[model samples]
Target chain A: MDLFINLAHGFSVALSPMNLLFCLIGALVGTLIGVLPGVGPVATIAMLLPITFGLPPVGALIMLAGIYYGAQYGGSTTSILVNIPGEASSVVTTLDGHQMARQGRAGPALAIAAIGSFIAGCVSTVLVAAVGAPLTKLALLFGPAEYFSLMVLGLVFAVVLAKGSVIKAVAMIMLGLLLSMVGSDIETGQSRMAFDVPELSDGIGFVVVAMGVFGFAEIIRNLENQSEETRSIVTSKVTGLMPTWPDLKASAGAITRGTIIGSILGILPGGGAVIAAFAAYTFEKKVSKDPSRFGRGAIEGVAAPESANNAAAQTSFIPLLTLGIPPNAVMALMVGAMTIHGIVPGPQVMTKQPDLFWGMIASMWLGNLMLVVINLPLVGVWVKLLQVPYRMMFPAILIFCNIGNYSINNAPFDVGMTAVFALVGYWLLKLDFEPAPMLLGFVLGPLMEENLRRAMLIARGDPMTFLYRPISATLLAIAVFLLVLAVLPMIRSKRDVVFVEGET
Target chain B: MSDGIQAPSGRSGGFRIRNQQDFYGGLVLVAVAAFALWASRDLPGMRGFAFGPGTAPRIFASILGALGLIVAVGGLVTDGPPVERVAVRGTALGAVLIAIFILVSNYATPITAGLGLRQYETVLAAIVVLLVTIAIARGADRGPLYVVAGTLVFAGTIRPLGLVLASFISIVVCAAATVEVRWRETILWAAGLTIFCALLFVYALNLPFNFWPRF
Candidate 1:
């Protein structure tokens, strides 16, 4: 098949010694950060971003992609060994994985998670090869109005995903959008609400906002309650790592079901790994005959969610590579990465930079392979890190974060902004308001506004163009259906699952 | 859930301080809105036409301002009982250390070693940090003193002394400071890393570096 040959060519690009080394390094670092409870792919990627400035696009992207999926692998390590989920996507893992740890079956929990992730990752990469081209062609159909409507729907969906009172979520999202306006006014080239600060000329860096609010705020919340504890995960104590034949049989169905679900969901705009993992866990729960075992160390819980999350992660790349749409925060960063290389991701990407495109796709499968080989064996080593006190860890992390952020532009203003945002995030956490929706709003707000205004200007101020356009109309309908069906009921329940581990 | 571990009778001062974040955020949102509202006051024309450049930001800011109020109110007036409060000692100390970092980063950049590149000011900064380890130890502890001595021996060797000597000194000093590095264990790990980094970064990739000492 022509596709096979193209893929082979992609392999040639990715298999280089230099690219291989970067991939290995990325896998190692991503896993290390992932195994650590507090650090995440986003922070790690952001720190590594400046280092990527000089490398050729292929090598840089290969390494960055490794971090994203590798993180999914590393995050599971924490969830299985301790009750902590390093990042949000692994929350479901903690339910079952931690139980396994308590039962002294942490080894099986970890092994199954890693293997499931690998299988899911491989299958999703295949799906990407098959579907990536078509979606790219489909993207060519979008005009400014369509993009505007799509972004609006995306932001709304994000708000809907926040498990809280819809009103408060909406409130936080709106506030987030406002926070985004503090720096430069794009259209008029005038400062918006900067209050004459020189830093206002450039908009607030997304990295600074995310790191300060999410990273530092998390540390503060952790520190305020020092009596909280994590059961030490002694790797030596874990037994039955090689899943029993029965255990393997049980998990195969979940991994298969999860991969299919993840691939499909991942293709949609802004519907990435976290959502897929959650959706798979929900599905696995519904299908299992013994539903009561959903939380207390269910291998299916770890397997299905981890598999789906990895599958989603790989397939999520399909959109960004094929259509230039960001499914989540990390993909948004990838967009920045691509832009730095003067390559815009869209229909033209497949045609113009076929090597970069195919190479990246081919490399993901290879990267996933590298991750398991790199991580599974080192489970023993990472478990040892849990012994380090958070007091010692915190200072190092803070200093590193400070250095990374300040060196970004050598601006004290950004540092101040980071501090302010951290406080804001802490407040949001304290108030039981989820800030996840706000982050979505920050990304989509300007894009949505731009598209909407452009559509208005182009159609000579006709509002009906939104409904009249086929693609825009279709997406809007889905948004409405989601709002009416799933989101409304979730909101109506008024019970929110705790995303933060310890909060008032 | 334990009987003896009474849930906080009410929000603790720490919780209260954190709780005020919603209001502070809301207030800033209000200010943002006021500024936007004032800026857009001059849009003299009717809105039946295409939007002016500033219209969306204005509307967006206003929406945010409105949303902030709801968040602030919900935060201030929640009827449900708050969750149990327990101290997280590790997290607290981390915060304190980080705050110190923020202070140092903001006010001082006392450049300490190796490439006088302002970025390397972290060296001097890290040296100051050893004081915390010392302070925490109380009085007459050898750990703090050994750390300084080891650091001096290590920092002494850098460019003037060559990589092996400098690194050996620094590691021995820092390792000796609080955590005793079994000389054998320290040497093995440190040597492994140096060889790995040199082979992978220096030899294989051939990426240029300031391997020579920065005068």
Candidate 2:
């Protein structure tokens, strides 16, 4: 009953005229970027982050949330139409989604994808509203030791889940931690890595790092691959915007199962929409009577991963909203945005700012509805956008990036820092190091350091105190288990085989 | 499907042992870590029971150094592709542009004072134009040139020319970098994008940027 009243209040806030308009704009821009290859949600969000600064906290969050899930919807459009996954989570969709397109069933494939995503988005938003309060309550119970242990577990998960050499990932995380140690120490006034620059006293801005690593690096990479094959739309005409009865029946079960699986995985640290989509696809293939049909226009293939990724994208907000921990790079940027708005994310956000919390929850449902209405009719417009050459597009992207970075602090130094990071990011890419883990580490570093210091102070420098606390001990144990599982040759080899199979 | 938009997998070329990327990457990390460790030596640490600023960084630096060693060692035994040659012209041009921005932003007054230029802003603008022209002449890819120029122009001119004019000029310059440059279309795009940005960022959102040059 109380939940109902709270949700009603949330609806009142979200349904306000201004908030709704921002939601529409966010969704439209998100879809635009998502349909364009190379320009991803991370860069797009980072670029648009400054725009949100002037918005009220609730409106800012609602719009950003709209963009996050809207990108998931738009990603499938490209996967089915152009045989390109606009987002990483949509990679698996390209296999069967493109196959269905090739068979001239692009309409049904796209319709099912949109419907599946809509269902998944609606379900997950409800799940977030229901489970988010309890999660926040639970997070409030954590002590400094527990918090430190949880962060350690998060870092381990980040390393284990990254699809490359574990050692390189660990190194990247350490480097991020080292980088985060720049500026003045919170407790002591001494600067760690500032090297005497006045700007170093405030630490490197998250926007700088994000734009540099993801935004600029991506632009350079796209330029390097200028000879990429032009994507041809699979069909000029998208007929029958609705799926057939049989097609609907086949996907109904997959959608339900995908929503469930994705919801669970999305709550886990480092378990993002990308992994959820992959896991759901693998689960569907394993359960299917005709697994051979997976890569050859399987409707279940189009439905399941699409649903799972959307569900995961929505639920990935759970960790960030409740526990103040970002599950991935996009969420990390959200944390940056929230911080810029003078709102520190965590358990307190739920208690002190119920309106903000519940309003954001309500807006997710509204945003999902907006996406379906916007996408279904606007498919042709998106297809037209697909024809825009990459060369023409790159400059616009670069300009936005420049203005975005500059607008953050009105500092050209940040722009320069972005340029430097772009080069560094490109180098890291060439070296097989994933930047996601480094980002996770950077975002969590200061908090982890603070928690570790507090925990040590409480323990009076006794390292064994971490083992004495049940929650901290359990979390640490899980981290160790995951590390061992990742390193063990037999398990590692089998995992690689599964990933390779999925890749093909 | 092609992993085109995803993060790089570092498996672009055929396998080689000699110039392993991890080897070079590890060396760089190790050098950075060592430098960090050495740099923090002067900072005080471990005041009473609580850890000081230096302790946490030292711990991180040491771990990074160890991980770097392991990665470097693994590179020796692991079979992987050689490090690909970086696009030197693009990279150098990018560096030069950044250096110029930083120098102009930080030391513009000092530089103009030293050179005794009566109109430092004009001199700075000329220098930017000259650098970009040289870069383009030296076969720096036009794509990067546009990006560099746009960023530099926005950074340098935002104060003098304001948000609207700065963005318009930057966008126009950037649009010319494309393979097929239509001046009319480029001008239209620049005008459209500039107005859109001005309205969205400056008017509706009301971000604290100068709409026109203060001077």
Candidate topping lDDT: 2
Q: Candidate 1: misplaced stretches above 4 Å?
A: A179-188, A235-241, A268-271, A292-296, A410-412, A484-487, A490-504, B1-28, B35-53, B70-215
Assess every candidate by TM-score.
Answer: 0.76, 0.91
Choose the strongest candidate by TM-score.
2
Instruction: Please write out the lDDT profile of model 1 over residues A1-504, one tens digit for every residue.
Output: 767887898899889899888788777777776666766666566555645655798888988888777776788888788777777778788888888888888878888898898999899988888887777778788999888777767666655554655556666667666666665655656566666657675767776667666666665565544345655565465656677887899999999999998888776644366678888999999999999998887889988999998898888887678766666667766866776677766678888888888888888999999877877777777788766555444434443354345445645445445655655565566656675666656655666666777898788888899999998998888778766664455434545553322210
Q: Give the alpha-carbon lDDT of every model.
A: 0.65, 0.79
Interface RMSD (Å) of candidate 2: 4.8
Stretches of candidate 2 off by over 4 Å are A490-504, B1-19, B87-93, B100-133, B136-149, B172-188, B213-215
Question: DockQ scores for all the models shown?
Answer: 0.15, 0.36
Please give the distance, in angstroms, between residue A326's alpha carbon in candidate 1 and its true position after superposition.
Answer: 1.6
lDDT of 2 at B24: 75
The pairs that clash in candidate 1 are A223-B91, A223-B92, A225-B87, A225-B88, A226-B87, A226-B88, A226-B89, A227-B87, A227-B88, B150-B173
Q: Write the per-residue lDDT of candidate 1 for residues B1-215, one digit (tens) a residue.
A: 01132224465553442235455545655675677677545543225666754577677767867766655554454434342222122223333434554465445654332345554343344345445544553222332233333333332233343444344334544443333236676566555544544454346545443344453
Model 2 lDDT per residue over A236-339, tens place: 68777788999999999999988988888877766478788889999999999999999999999989999998898889889889988887788888998998
